[model samples]
Target: MATNSIKQPLWAVVLLLPTLSSCGSMAAWWTDIGPSFVLQNASTGLLTHSLCHSNNTPLYPTDPPVAFKTKYAPKNGTSLTATGWYDTMTTWASLFYQNNNDDIVNAVYKCNFETGTYEEIESDVISDRSGTPPPNAQTGLSVALLGQQEGYRVFYHDRARALHTLKFTQVENWSYGNPISTSTNRSGLALGSMFSGVRNVTVVTPKDVANIETIRLNIDNAWHITTFPTPLRGSNVTNLSNLTSLPYDTSSPPPFSLQGWDGNPKAIGIAIDTVLTRHIFYIGTDKAVHSYAAFVTGLTESGFRAQPDQSNEYWPLADEPNSDFAIASHLGSSTIRLYYLSGGQLIEAKYKNGNWDPASRLVVANTTVFTNNTGPVEEDNGLSTGAKAGIGVGVTVGALLLITGGVAAWILRKKKSTTSDVEAHGDEGASTTAGGAMGATQPASTAQSPDVASQHAEIARTGSGLSTEKWDTDVKDMALTPPPRELESPNLASELPQGIDRNELPTKHHITELP
Candidate 1:
């Protein structure tokens, strides 16, 4: 009778594997979602990463993710942005973040696609070729790689309330652009940027807190700015803070449950797809993801005004997010991924195959990558909202382990013995970033130190060191838009389908946009 009691649980465990495997297709998750995302450890405030690998799925909590401390620890609610080059032949990634002192720090890493690992190359303050770095940045900052010798640009808001740019190349080094004059003061510190072909576009919310200011670097190598009105500044919408604003009652959809905008950091997530359609994402007053798509016209002031397609339905899954978020799209790919931190959990949403997937996952936020954030992880460095969330998760996990621990232990022993170290010994070195779209990779150690080029060479190499003719509308011969196009779905509606959980309470908006 004793032997049978012990054996029964093991049989149940064997049966549960297939059920968990099919619950959500592991293959489908990777194909539709993405490869990885970057995060700031809420516990330690250091940079950490969460990724998907062939050998592992969310089903297994056995082998935890390894986190290497990447020196830049962002402020409590700072924005995080990344840009890099990735293709079959090359991969390089760079992460730009605002540190505690409000300085813009750059961390470059060499990535192995085969083993899903990041090897640090260099970490330092961004400076010009003259070895002069730019001014300290406020919370809102963004970066982009503008192809070849055109180099990369990091745009940030300064304490003086001015928008500034740091443009750099491998040979010419770094130089500061004149402070950009805005149509209005940036009442909301929301800023985001994307680069493609011959144009780079950045958008910020001016003092009005309602309209969007589009800043463009045209084919002529000059900056042109335009402001567009959005439905954001509705009568009920007011600048408040998450702490004070009326929490949104997400028991049902809007009209029935929409709340006003509180003082939440409007961290913008932006990406460009293969169709020349540029999309921007931000947290609405209701704390859901509101999306707008436009076909780039390549003109100066009205560059993004033409063919604007706004989605009527907001992605409700993106509720109550922290100020930092990201959007990433692969080179010439139709898929775009959105990521944000909510209650210390990293939520991922996807817009692909001409529709937004109503399904979003609480990704690595639940995994061991967040070991510190997954419990009452009080650390000396600092832990805020994310750490508190772990108390509940810790209790539930403990209850579950008490029931299955013996069965799990025996099974784990059997599984571990059969699982051998058979991953490829060597692979090409590329790039790593938390917020940008990255190429597919295999599992590898995060400890390897790969050979890297000189600092200048890294700047050029990270962006593929290939520059085409500058985008000139007058240049009839240059190909600015790629030829591939998606057949427009005439039946497509402007709204996204809602994904709701009846048991959970919804967030109310009370956030004020911080400059």
Candidate 2:
């Protein structure tokens, strides 16, 4: 009787092993999907720099060695813009600009973090195609990496108002997609306004592309954001075809509208943090910089709400503004950095602890660097907002074990009582059969342990480089801030073009434009 009681409790423990193993697997999956903070140490090095024009003195200190320099003078008519991302230990930068022949070209270069040396891939001619006219040559370009396999895709809008895309998979392999229009007319998407991050890509334009009405891409990889029909300018509704539309078929209508979209596509930029939070910066018609935050829901739904934030009048008030801006989320930290061009200088502002830090100039006016402002892109820093939540799951597992232990004790007590009754009845043979059944369950438990341990090992290996203690500390410091107060009125709406209604604009626009 005593031996039977001991055996019954052991069998109960073996049955609970699978449940414990599942808890560990859930914890690891939570960590895997979180934001990456792998490149925290790589950003300290000096970046390449040059004067915007030859005659001007260097704006930043020359002590930090320049990574690369351009011989062309800004005053002599040159156009240049740069975008970059980090791929593990390698920092990749792509520059797109108008060359001496007034044609657009793309140059790709990789920098080894350990060596700090730049290797340039042979430059590729992106413009000057057979059917493309001189006026329709590329005017602006933006590049984004779609993981390591897809390489990079470059976006631009031409003079004919058509959106064009060029993909570069390797040094010699380049492919161009057909041109697409944002409106029914020949007018296409705006120049230098398309931006992409992770799985999401957005373009800001005054009109719709093809029959698609929204400017954002959802999880379906189709143009499916719910939006009001673009305001009509004239009676003609031409059915212009978009030759460059992505190969995917669009069969479903978008479910929701792009929040805070004011129908203007000019002077806008976007960035996504490690956890997929989106920040959009734009020069409002008031000539001040305004930012909006879009919170993602599930895999496909996003709530785009206007952030109650705006910068002083730091942007130019010109019709065709030369100012541009970029955004990046600091690695391993909740800090978000905004870099913009103002008065020919590179100015930076930080958003942390729920407030925007005052803007400070980093490089003097006209100092140029090949930075798109979307910081190191490829580091899988094993830290993210979701990873921090996994700690809570660990606590819950402990509670589950406690409950399971109590159940085992109760079962043991019942078995002991049954054994005593059986001994009194002289049913020794029945007790032996029950003990054999318990022993038979042991092999299945043995088989499952190896698989469970293998899964646990894999997750541990993936997160081995990250420190859980440091990740927890960083998350606690980055608690979400409350929404900001709305801007005061007499704002950007007063400066809008004739067709736009001021009532449709946000209320209380209290912001000043920058010089």
Candidate 3:
């Protein structure tokens, strides 16, 4: 009897031990905390700086040093609006220079970020050949990027008034070389300002080639042979027309397309989040920001396929019209930020979980127009917003653990009398028969360990509360101001460009006429 009583309690303890240890396996909870801080110029206070790599190589001062300013001069009483940037992110940044002086012409220029200047890199100057008279030239540069593998990949708009893709490899610098001779007026198709996978998309136009029907560079042939129109025929690129914007498809469709997007013509190519699953970012078109998702595979000719099937839907962006938008991904968060020129000043908005939050103004320009105000800016820095948020959550979790421990102790003590007496009575008969065992197993020392039922309750309350509290804290902190950075400067510029001779610059929009 004595031995059985001892074994029973020991067995019970063993069984309860597993239940207690399992408490640590609770579900993990996370929430989007957004950017910890937004750094801007003290003068113009622009949040985004248009980013580009001069040679696909890392440079000094600007980290990899891939972006540049959109400075321009007026011609014949007309604003010669243009956009320029270093194209690739390698050791050499090919400059995508667009001289949108009403002709939709482009030239690849090589820029030296170390010296802070540029020179025309390409021998040929290419212009849009839509065969239709030019509607104002697309303000942004076109880029054809190489994916990670050796193959031909093209990103351009087709005649259906939609964006299209043709995957091939082995092409290099088709934009500068004038490789394809199609007479399509597919002007302003440069590599996207952003990256997808291993390379940027390549843009090209047919150079008066006959019988070719379709024009695409053969990437496997080193971009030298423009004969391989195989992918174009296989896909939808065979008969092209009405191509609008060129956005890299980063969706499950393995190169999802951004098609039929027309709103703000200036809203050309927007930046995308390379690290995000949804990959949300903004591009300016008709002065509005359009959102996109990358890496989705189910997209077909009919549009985004249904999920389970991963189907997609088209949402019209009517909010914040007439403002140019530049977006960057907030590191490690679902939040995508949009920096735009609005109300004559710089402003920002954050998109998360498919919703565009209200716009927050970042710069104030109540008066004079400034140079470098032609486009929005962006940057990718080494600072960490996710880490700061993690630290905050850790502190909260630690506090919760401490408090739960104290509460568990209080509960145990409150139930101690009944639990201890029951345990003592159970052992008394067997212990008294065993010589001197009663004193050895005194009631004080033999009190039952807290019940499993009580422990489960404690865990349920603590774990659930901790998750909820953490989420609430994250949402609240999204509205909190971000920290300051030493390297980042405000987008605001106090000085105008050197070429802006006071007499030459437009004065307060004195009703100008075209040439």
Candidate 4:
């Protein structure tokens, strides 16, 4: 009987090969799920698809992502954290934090679809018990690292009492592997008084991945700024200040008189509208949410500054969100969202129509409390309700269909209708041509003008608009290609022995300003 059973499975396996092979050859699962994978690359001002959604379901409200908690968010609410999203072939949201021991911190984590968890793909600490803790380490400690181009990490070192930026690229196993990269210290950019007022960094995509820059705000001085461009040889931190009390408008200078913030701005977040200009949002120390329009003017002079508008542009004054907390925009748009944990309950808020709307407390289940040691295993798909409905309907009506094995499972689809929709959903014949000639890679255009096709191909590799040959090597390995091993030279390692010259100014160059 056992031999017969084994033989039966073998026969079934032999019969199933052709059917499975046919299905594999014709389907385009990756392209259909492309939109759900929108990744924002703050460096290049571009967005790409994520690896997680490449061959599976798209991420969205209708599809609803399954959250996989990392082994990072603590069992208790004690540590401070930082997070941001990047656009590549997919949209990936990354949250970084320090463990109570200051020595523990993962560089990057990827969201897992099958298990609905965030797993660490890289850890940055060089030594187990290294470095002095940050200022808030003893009484309170936090780890905040903003992801940037060329695998650079912008984090605050509390023990050292400074904000330092380190840029390193990882290859092979992410166990803090051999680095083939570089680093430049940016402590001066957010030094002393600067760090005093600043709380968080909000990455903005001013233009497509080519002209990406960070807008730094000194909450205490109400100062705003961006970093100097490359080949300057060191960190050239530029202070963006206009003598006028109000903020500068990206399109045109602010017109007329405006009521400015009388109190110091504390908590800050930035978002860009559909037109691609930036809008600055912050909560003043006086407990008021404020808005500003930031711009760099006097292209020939050192005159970059922020114009704080206190007109009807501000929101949630006095009565709402009066505590210290964190704010982040949702995955896709400029609409800002806020999160805070009170009494072990998580609550959220949003900015709408120039006012803040409070969201009900997020009821995280008892069994689902994401802890430090244990990660978020899987998300509840809310399938029990569907199961109940299926049972209530009974199975009698489909008995004949089940016996004939002819009932096809329903396929999920997005609502957007356009040429993109057609490409995402695929032609009716996509399922039958996966491994076939239908899905073969196409030759990129060799047109003259600005080389848009090559640009897309370059974006596909480095997740940026700026072309990178070194990053192309990293991309090839991440794509599961066999990478050639070479010796790790000291020069190839990422390090900046000499710190930055804090006083350098940015050069003036103009692109067509957004309308």
The backbone clash count of each candidate, in order, is: 34, 23, 81, 40
lDDT of 4 by residue, 1-515 (tens): 00011122211211211011000000001111121222111122111122232211222111111222334332222223333221221113333333445443443444343222334443444223223223224111222221122332333333432223322332311122111111122211111111100122333211111112243432232213342111122233333222111122344332332122322222234543222234544343345544444432322222113454333222334322323334433211223444333333223344432334344332221112323343222222122222212211212211100011011121111212211111222231222122111111111111223443243222112211111223211211111022111111111111111111111101111112211
lDDT of 1 by residue, 226-296 (tens): 44433322223222211112223234332211123333345665666655466655565555665555663
| TM-score of each model, in listed order | 0.55, 0.45, 0.32, 0.37
lDDT head-to-head 1 vs 2, winner: 1
Which stretches in model 3 have alpha-carbon errors above 4 Å?
1-97, 100-140, 144-193, 199-265, 274-323, 329-335, 351-358, 363-515
Q: What is the C-alpha lDDT of each candidate?
A: 0.39, 0.32, 0.24, 0.25
Better of 3 and 4 by lDDT: 4
Q: Which ten residues in a row have the lowest lDDT in candidate 2?
A: 22-31
User: Sorted by lDDT, highest first, which candidate order results?
Assistant: 1, 2, 4, 3
Which candidate gets the maximum TM-score versus the true structure?
1
* Candidate 2 error regions (>4 Å): 1-59, 62-81, 86-90, 110-121, 128-138, 170-172, 180-199, 206-214, 217-266, 299-303, 310-322, 329-335, 341-345, 352-355, 363-515
- How well does candidate 2 match the true structure, expressed as C-alpha RMSD? 25.7
Tens-place lDDT digits, model 3, residues 1-515? 00011122222211211000100100001112111111122222111122112111111111211122323211111111122211111011222222336332222233232232333332222334323223233222233332212222223333332233333222322221222222333322222333222212222222111111223232132221121111221233322322232222233233333322322222332333213223322233333344443332222112111112111112234234332233343222334544444444334454554455454433211111112222111121121332222212212110101112233334355434211111221231222222111011000111223452242123211001111111111111111122111111122111111111111110010111111
